[model samples]
Target: MAEGGKGSRSGSDSDDQSAVETNLTATVNKVDGLEVQLVLQVRGLKPKGGLRSFLSKFSNHDNPTDLCANAEFTKWDVTSSSLSIEICVHTEKERKKKKGKHDVNTVNTETFTYKISNFPSEIRPEKTTLEIKQPPGETSYSFIVLTLQRVDKSVSWENFRTPRNS
Candidate 1:
């Protein structure tokens, strides 16, 4: 029957959709004095002109296209203290700049302030880690650990302050 054939086709389409995989990578950089930026890059999206592409436009699903990174810092000096910083980046398509009559594509970078206290107070760089959770699907409940090591070895308290007058 025609209905049965249509149902089979839909099932096949769903299978093809599930076969699409999304890959993400996170990187951290210290741009300025005590200013740290975390960048999340997403790949493996369905190309233009396809069923998946059309469905993505209509669906309200929160795909991994957009990602948010949160950094939590914990320190214990007699008492335990914590600080949290969150930053989010929208997909390339979602972030478009209007240049005259046409839209211009530009590299999008999301940034958040990272306090020096987040790192151990020492002369050497240290390793810090954060976990990223993906959206619900075949890879649902999955977590990715991002390990970032400070690249600057000369950061110290003296560099952060000016000399006091006697």
Candidate 2:
């Protein structure tokens, strides 16, 4: 009977983990030229007493996705348009330096932001790709392949300099 109970508990934990993964998948959208936003809602992760507090030390809800963007600079003729991307983090940090007040570990109850810019304009169409790699020891990743239609709106922020034949 004890073995059965342990198996059931493990199954339940697996279900919880699957739910957490489903919640983490974010939707990406273009907020403006050279800017995009990844949006998601996260909740319901409570570890045991001391473990909860201990694990919170490594949690960074802001920019949890660790999003990164890339483009081919050799295929297209790009002008200097100051291309850039930004991420906004809405969580508050625990101020350990302040005295008397207890430090509060913030959760992912808010949105986070990240930004990257100064992309070269000489991007080409040599199979440009955008990938979001998972953190170390993780098994999942999100990927998007470049196509003409996807590039049309994505490369609209700046003018591209057409590639020169070799």
Candidate 3:
């Protein structure tokens, strides 16, 4: 009975995840003329420094990590069009002035780009998850999640209707 209970619980958890994914797709793929937005949410990060690096999995809803990227375009414009996201994060050097010793962690700015070429023009909505990798040395963080979704909008008059006492 305990085994069966665990199986059911896992099944329900998968169901919940599937439902959330479905809702995200529905939200992005509606009304052919509205707009398609690329939202970058950082799930985790680790500043590279050998074994001393700390992995940060951000879960703060109140203060989210700024990915510094927001790209939006029309449904028709974005359809079948190539998209490239290039971001550069620079970390300055920190000086430790204790006991006349200076420890500097100077990380340079890296402008890395990830591109999606020729998005499918089919009527079916598509979703793709990409991993933005960080170079081996002198970079801010490594291993980030990037979700790509295209929305189609077919505007309706009901959206613009005002309340009336007919």
Candidate 4:
């Protein structure tokens, strides 16, 4: 249940789903303990195949045609059993002339959450992808892509934290 928070996922460990070992990467802009940038490959945006791919089309109307643009990881929390990934997407930004300075700002954030667990990652990389799996009772191979998943070491932080002022 990775894309746009649709579908239920099986906690059962099985190999029926297609496993694509993809190495994930992100753009780390601000590291005051929050806001990690995710560089989404446009190709990955398209579902691997099947019903999920068909459903993906309808779910992305409000979002940009290209899902990778201006993407960031707003939340990265890990526990003993699972890792929580919350990514937010923004539309193209506009620069406004404020006094003598020009400031770039964009709004209208769309978020998608994914849970990373159950299926074990054979190896750990700096950055990694969340597997998109069909929930229990759905066809076994509808939509499944095993992507590399792990936060890059460069974006170091002791624990998940929000803006200090917040």
Candidate 5:
């Protein structure tokens, strides 16, 4: 009975270690690809309430107005020291008037474009500020951001890189 317990414990420990190794190996493999810039532009519009309310309760507010863009480098093979991304904004106005309806309603449409690449600078430094605001009664929401993720190229490569950091 004592021998069986010891064997089971050893097997469990080995399994745990194997799982950890597999996860680490997978993460390293993901980073081996050439790094590319990812420009993620997020905009907030007035809440169109429905089943979406259950999922995004926070976005619903009376005065909703704010937009943000985030930049990151990933999804490639080259190891780059710098990254750059660009965000562009455009607006369109639509007039809605009915022949037998009450009045004309104007709709404002906003569009954003993201240009991502691996470089050393930003396309528009003034527009790239971390904080943005909308006028009047400003209702805003922000998100937790992630910068970078380490990728392992090879076990041999990691062995050398790990010692340099220490």
Candidate 6:
């Protein structure tokens, strides 16, 4: 009886350890025009809700925004122990049609796959800032800085400009 009790307690302790939440960190960069890539090394991950449970709820709902509020890193690849996501940055002119209003420069984003097997050699380095925000009413947020140096300087206007006719 004593041995069985000890075994059960050890199993319960292991289960408790596995349920602990872990914070994830990642490196992000923009490569090849408007593509943003993220490289994450994660040991374990847990969303606010279970991934499958959230997806099931999302599929039954008509509004797409609900899914965005529920899930994290929806587009990810888990191979062995690494995760990568390649997203696209979309910029649009948001014009408010009111009694009198000017055009607004608002940016929106979409996700796409960006593979970086052989990075270009003539690209310069640049830095990008990222801010992670929770839902509008929540007070949880994070700021991250990323270094992305991949610009081709050879294609600038100085290389192909002719002297203006004076």
Summing lDDT over every window of 10 consecutive residues in candidate 1, give the lowest-scoring window. 1-10
lDDT of 6 by residue, 1-166 (tens): 0000011111121112211222334444334453334333222111233575456543543322232332234333323222233332232334565577654444333322322323322333223322222334433222222233434533332212111110
How do all models score by TM-score? Answer: 0.21, 0.20, 0.31, 0.28, 0.24, 0.23
**Cα lDDT over the full model 1:** 0.29
Candidate 1 local lDDT, 38-125, one digit each (tens): 3332221112234654565465423323222221112112111122233322222222445664443332222222222344333212
Q: After superposition, how far is residue 34 of candidate 4 from its true place, in Å?
A: 31
The alpha-carbon deviation from the true structure for residue 32 of candidate 1, after best TM-score superposition, in angstroms, is: 0.8
Strongest candidate by lDDT: 4
- lDDT tens string, model 5, 73-162? 122122233222222222222344568754333322232222223323223322222223233453331221113332332312221111
Give the 10-residue window scoring lowest on summed lDDT in candidate 6.
1-10
Give the lowest summed-lDDT range of ten residues in model 3: 1-10
TM-score for candidate 3, residues paired by index: 0.31
Number of backbone-clashing residue pairs for each candidate, in the order shown: 0, 20, 8, 7, 7, 4
Name the best candidate (by TM-score). 3
Higher-scoring candidate on TM-score, 3 or 4: 3
lDDT, model 5, position 162: 13
Residues 110-136 of candidate 2: C-alpha lDDT, one tens digit per residue: 111111223333233232323332234
Worst 10 residues of 4 by lDDT: 12-21
Runs of candidate 3 exceeding 4 Å displacement: 1-33, 42-80, 103-105, 122-166
Q: In model 6, what lDDT does residue 16 have? A: 24
Show where candidate 1 strays beyond 4 Å: 1-23, 44-166
lDDT of each: 0.29, 0.26, 0.29, 0.35, 0.24, 0.29
Which residue pairs in candidate 4 collide? 8-135, 22-148, 128-148, 128-149, 128-150, 129-148, 129-149
Q: Write the per-residue lDDT of candidate 3 for residues 1-166, one digit (tens) a residue.
A: 0000011111121112211110010112222343333333211123333332223233222211232222111111113345444443343344555687656444333333334454433222234333334446624334444334444444332232111110
Residue 130 lDDT, candidate 1, scale 0-100: 38
